[model samples]
Each structure stands twice: as structure tokens, then as C-alpha cells.
Target: MRDLRARFRAAYGASGWHLLLLVGCFAVAAWVALRLAGEATAGRMLLWFVGAVVAHDLVLFPMYAAADWALRTAVRERRARPASGPSLLNHLRVPALAAALLFLVYLPGILRQGRETYLAATGQDQQPFLARWLLASGALFLASGIRYAFRRWRARRG
Candidate 1:
């Protein structure tokens, strides 16, 4: 395995050829997937892929990044307390991202020709993913609440 890896590294030299090969592999894989799942299904996959990429770049990442940066910056400051209060809003970094990503995955189908892949993956004719997203959001909030409650209880008991 090591010898083969070393030979491959020497030959490929990590260049455009490698990227071309990767794209070729993906093309073959996509073809196979379309064959197995049907061309209609493959077309849907393309739409979902585009929607997911757009959302991950535009929406979900920005929220998570901003919250993470804000938290880190708050900690770095010499101020006795962060200017932002220690409130539920300040700690919603993970939940907000989850909610946003969930929403984005569902949004591509809104008032437009819905992506087949999104519908297939979500198992709903319309807006089924939203129900699941809501359930997940509720779960995230419940878990957060339980953790906070437990910590408070522990502090009181001790």
C-alpha cells in the first residue's frame, strides 16, 4: 500500500491531471448512479446539489461563522463582561445553523419547480422536510434546555 501510494504521489505530482481524473471519476460515478436510480432521479440530484452548495455558502456558514467569531471575540476582550448579555440568543450558534440549513434544504422547492432530488431525499410531495426540520429544531432546543436545567439543579444541590 505504501509503495503504491508513493508511486502514485511521484507520478501525479498533485496537478491539474489529478483534478481532471477526479472529475472523470465523478462523471463515471454519476453515470452509474443515473443508470441505477434513473435519469429523472439524476436530474433531481443536480438541482439539490446546486441548492445545497448555494445555501451552505450563502446562509448556514455565515450565521455559524458570525456567532463563532462573536463568541471568540467576546472571550478575547479584557472587558469584565461581554457587551452582549449571556442570553439564549448568544448561545444559539448550533441551533441557528441547524435551522438555517434545514430551511435552505426546503426553500429550493418553494413557489417554483421543485427539485426532484430534494423531494425524493425528503420523502414529501411538498414541504415534508419542513416538518422534520421543525422536529429537529425542537429537539435541539429541548436538549439545550435540559442541559441548562440539569446544570442549575446540580449547582443548587451541591
Candidate 2:
């Protein structure tokens, strides 16, 4: 059994489960493509996909990569001792990523771009989106800060 597993891993470059999961994901993607093929909006979806890929590759990727580099550098420079675990960089990163995802998901509502259409459809105002997003982001940061501080306190006590 060990020899068989080793030979399979050597040939596949990962465990059998990894190959199974990869095949499953590809199957789902193929299903989605087949379903979308009959849709009239497929062309528009394709155009949007291409645009999103271009935007992420050309703009967002660089911006975030540079920002991460700067943050990592700043944290490393100020640290007098090597981090034991859960570096400050990661604590800051988690909140920032969560906030960014929230902002991206609610961009239209937050920016009030389709205020009239949104109001007509949901019978609700878009006025609260920006404030709610800000508050949620602030809460996330605050919680992360509290958790980091607690960890540091426990580490010091130990």
C-alpha cells in the first residue's frame, strides 16, 4: 500500500484526493460553461470577464502588491526582535482584505451609482451603504486590533 501510494504521488505530484478535487472543480466549471453557452448574455459575460481579468492584472494586482511590499517593509524595519508567531503584518492584512472585499462587493451601492434603480427595485435608499460599509470596516479593524493586543498580552504573560 505504501509503495502504491508513493508511486501514485510521484506520478501525480500530489495525493489522490488532490487529483479528485481538481477533476471535480473542472467538471463544475465545464457544467457552468455549458449552461452559459445557451444564454443570450454570454457575450456580455465574456466581455466582462476579459475586462475584469485585464483590470486585475494591469491595475489592482500591482497596486496591492506594492502596498503589501511597503507594509511588510515598514513592519520589518520597526521590529526590534523577530516575530514569534502571528506577525503584526498579518493582523493588519486580515482586516484590510476583509474591508477591501466588502468595498468591492458593495461598490455600486456605496457609491450610490444606481440610486434610482436600487430604490425602485428594493424600495430602500442607498444612503446607508457608505456609512454601513465604513462602520463595518471600522469594526473589523477594531476587532483585529483587540485580538492582536490580547495575543501580545498573553505572550508577554507566558
Candidate 3:
């Protein structure tokens, strides 16, 4: 069993389950592409897809990479103990990423750009979006800070 597993892993560069999941994802993507190809809006969809790829590669990736590099440099400069169990970088990163994603998802609402159309469609005002987003972001950061403090306390205690 071990030999067979090793052979499969050697051939696939991953375990059987991982390979299966990869193939499943590919199959779903192919299905979605085929369906999209048959649609009248395929060209527009393709344009959006290409634009997203280009925007992420050319804009978002570099921006985030630079931010992360700067953050790491600052953290490294301030570190007093070399024996810390884990860095606080990820703790900050996870919440910031979540908040950023939420902001992106609700950008039009947060900016109050679609007020008339939103009111017409939903019969509700878009006035709360900015406040809600701010509150959510603040809560997320607070939770992340508490979690980091707890982890640091446990690390020091143990």
C-alpha cells in the first residue's frame, strides 16, 4: 500500500485526493467555459475576464506585494525577541484582506454611487453602506488584534 501510494504521489506530484480535486475543478471550469461560449454575452464576459486578469497582474499584485514588503520591513525592525513562536504578520494580513474584499464587494454602495438605481430597485436607501462597512472593518481589526494578543499571551505562558 505504501509503495503504491508512493508511486502515485511520484507520478502526480500529489496524493490521489488532491489530484482528483484538481481534475474535478478543471472539469467544472471547462463546463462553465463551454456554457459561456454558447452565450451571446460571451465576448463581453471574456473581455471582463481578461481585464480582471490584467488589472490584478498589473495593478493589485504589485500594490499588495509592495505593501507586504514594507510591512515586513517595519515588523522586522521592531522585533525585540527572536524566540517568538509566530509572527504577527498573518494576524494583521487576514483581517485586512477580509476587510478589503468586503470593501471591494460593496464599493458602489459604500461610495453611494448607485443611490437612485438602488432605491428604485430595492426601495431602500444606500445611506447605511458606508457606515456598515466602516463598522465591519473596525470589528474585524479589533477581533484580529484580540486574537493576536491571546496567541502572544499563550506563547509567553507556555
- TM-score result, candidate 2: 0.67
lDDT of 2 by residue, 43-87 (tens): 888889889999899988998889878878778744424356445
Ranking of predictions according to lDDT: 2, 3, 1
Q: Which residue pairs of candidate 1 clash?
A: none
Query: How does each model score on TM-score?
Result: 0.39, 0.67, 0.64
Model 2 lDDT at residue 135: 99
Best by lDDT: 2
For candidate 1, the per-residue lDDT at 110 reads 41
Q: Which residue runs does candidate 3 get wrong by more than 4 Å?
A: 1-49, 77-82
* Count of residue pairs whose backbone atoms collide, per candidate: 0, 0, 0
- Count of backbone collisions within predicted model 1: 0
Candidate 3 colliding pairs: none
Q: Better model by TM-score, 2 or 3?
A: 2
Residue 49 local lDDT, model 1:
76
- Residue 29 accuracy (lDDT) in model 3: 86
Candidates' RMSD to native: 8.3, 6.6, 7.2
Ranking by TM-score: 2, 3, 1
Top TM-score hit: 2
